[model samples]
Target chain A: MPFFKITLIRSSIGLPKKTQGVLNALGLRKRMATVFKPVNPSTAGQIMKIKELVAVSEVEAAMTSAEMKALRKPDPGYYIETPGLG
Target chain B: MFGPFRATSPLSGGLLWKIPWRLSSPQKRRQRKRLRLVDNVVATVDAALKRQNMESGRNLVRWKEEMPTEEEMRPKDKYTMFDRKEKKYRKGIHKLPKWTRVSQRINPPGF
Candidate 1:
């Protein structure tokens, strides 16, 4: 399934109320907030509404909410070595 | 004469003092080189292990902790009690306006 990676680069402030509503509905309330939605007609239409404020890219597969959250998290650098890995 | 005998005495300190220092000089340099090599090896191994752990979806930077099986681990415990307490008590959940820096360090020995 195709996925769309959408990042709100521009702020919704000072934009039209309807445009701001679109951003809020998309879960992009802050600048640089990223949301991933499946590539469907409804999502495509929503992207079109705020195309100027967001950067969108279509990817091969959509990540789950947990996976997206993990992606945004920084990696902790150390790991305990199992007896065999050591 | 007694003066000539004193001047040529074998107990003169100069030769013996310089001999020990000169003998150990080369050995000390070699020992330092060996220590440097060992340190580099350790650093390289650490880097490789860190990369491998990250690729396997584990964080290696934290202190050595017990590796919990997927079934045994409590995911909810990952969030601290303080965070949950704050959420329960706070009336409104507002986003932080900007980044803030907080220092958290435990004093080690002689620190």
Candidate 2:
């Protein structure tokens, strides 16, 4: 099954109550928060409710929260060049 | 920012603080892009759901026919919203509160 990759692009601050509720329901508490939902009527309907607040894309696989976090983590400036001889 | 009427005193008046009535060119460009993005999302979801239904042998036609395709929507639906209080019973979409995050695509049938 495909998944809808949703990223909150716009802030929901001062928006209607229901709009805030929808974003929270989608697990988006801050801007740029990304969540993957299976493509179904329920998810589609939810997206419809907050369509303007997010950027949506369809992907074949859903990444775990940890994976998403890792993607955003910066790399260290240096890596261990030499380990003890085997 | 000045007062809404530029002068709070009852006897005093000047240029009123006015919100631009029309969207600027950049605003219009971004608005159209936003509209198109939403349309793209809807189409993606519809196509995926249709594929899922086909795989499951569930021939549900309601959702398939319900979502309006991008080309099927009129410019009025994309740009203006029906507002009884505004002149001509319509208003620029940017006039809507939280418009950047709110979808106001469909209007009343006769509007």
Candidate 3:
């Protein structure tokens, strides 16, 4: 099944109440927040409501919450290595 | 009068004995022992290598520079999409500030 990845690129602060509600329903509270929903009439309506503020792309598989968080997190380089043995 | 600077040694005969000076902690003492062993091994290897190099009249510095310089290693014709795009944008927009006539030329209406 196709999954639509909706990312809020712009803020919907001054937009209509219904547009903000659509964004809130999709779990996008702040800018750059991404939410994946299955391609359906309900999701299409939400995307249409906030079309100007979001960038949508369809993907084959949906990523879990942990996987999505890991993708956005940067790696903390450097591990302590003892000379001989710690 | 003696010099202002004095070398303080941990094993000073009478002066050190009078004061309550403790040796390094157990962990620090073990670390010092390991460091001394490594230093001794390095000195021995360095001495042997120095003797060999002296016989051949070649210094260690020459071997260190075996790799080419950065300018030589990197290709002159190397191009990145980001750099090219940035240069094109800069040329097209010039030094004029954004939301100006030049910016309008580069980024037309609704772009």
Candidate 4:
């Protein structure tokens, strides 16, 4: 399924409770936070409610949590060629 | 001659909150920019849906087709909103609560 990659580019502080609730429902907890949601009627409606506070784009597939964590994981200075157990 | 300026609230009979009657030039510029961004997002979604042949994103297609282009918008609509009070039935954007956080693009027809 195509996913809508939403990023909370702007803060929701002091906005209406409804708007804030939409952001919360979208899983955008803070500024610069990003969440991928399947593109559908409900998600589109949510995006419309908080369009001013977010940036949205479409992607082919949602990234898994492991893949996202790997992207953020740093490369250590050294890598072991042989395992201790092996 | 003007005395030394002291920016202080009055002892009594002053409003605790004040909203500007008009949007400043910079504020107007930013507002226009935001509207443009929203338009861009809609267009992007429409294109993405078309590419994937997704029929569920109907709003994106209908919205893009109905909303006026930035160039086609009236100057009044571009910069201000409809208000029952004030001259011309329009007022400064800042007067609206959470003006920056909400979309105020659409106004009453013939307003």
Better of 1 and 2 by TM-score: 2
* All candidates: TM-score: 0.38, 0.73, 0.38, 0.75
lDDT of 1 by residue, A19-46 (tens): 8888988999898887877655556556
lDDT tens digits by residue: candidate 4, B3-102:
4554545423577556567788999888788878887776666666566666644555556666775666777777788888777788777777877766
Q: Which prediction has more favorable lDDT, 2 or 3?
A: 2
Looking at candidate 3 chain B, the ten consecutive residues that score lowest on lDDT are B98-107
Q: Give the per-residue lDDT digits (tens) of candidate 2, residues B1-111.
A: 385767455436665656677788888778778777877766666677777873311222433355454466686666678999988998888888878766666667787
Q: Which stretches of candidate 1 lie over 4 Å from their true place?
A: A72-75, A82-86, B1-111
| Candidate 3: C-alpha RMSD after superposition | 29.8
In model 2, pairs of residues that clash are none
Query: How big is the positional error of residue A71 in model 1, measured in Å on the Cα after superposition?
Result: 3.3
Task: Write down the DockQ of candidate 4.
Answer: 0.36
lDDT of 1 at A57: 65
lDDT of 3 by residue, A18-86 (tens): 878888899999988888886654555555455546767667788887999898888878788779874
Cα RMSD for candidates in order: 29.8, 4.7, 29.8, 4.3
lDDT of 4 by residue, A1-86 (tens): 88999989989998878888998899999998889998776687678667778899998889876888899999998977876785
Top-DockQ candidate index:
2
Question: In model 3, what lDDT does residue B84 have?
Answer: 36
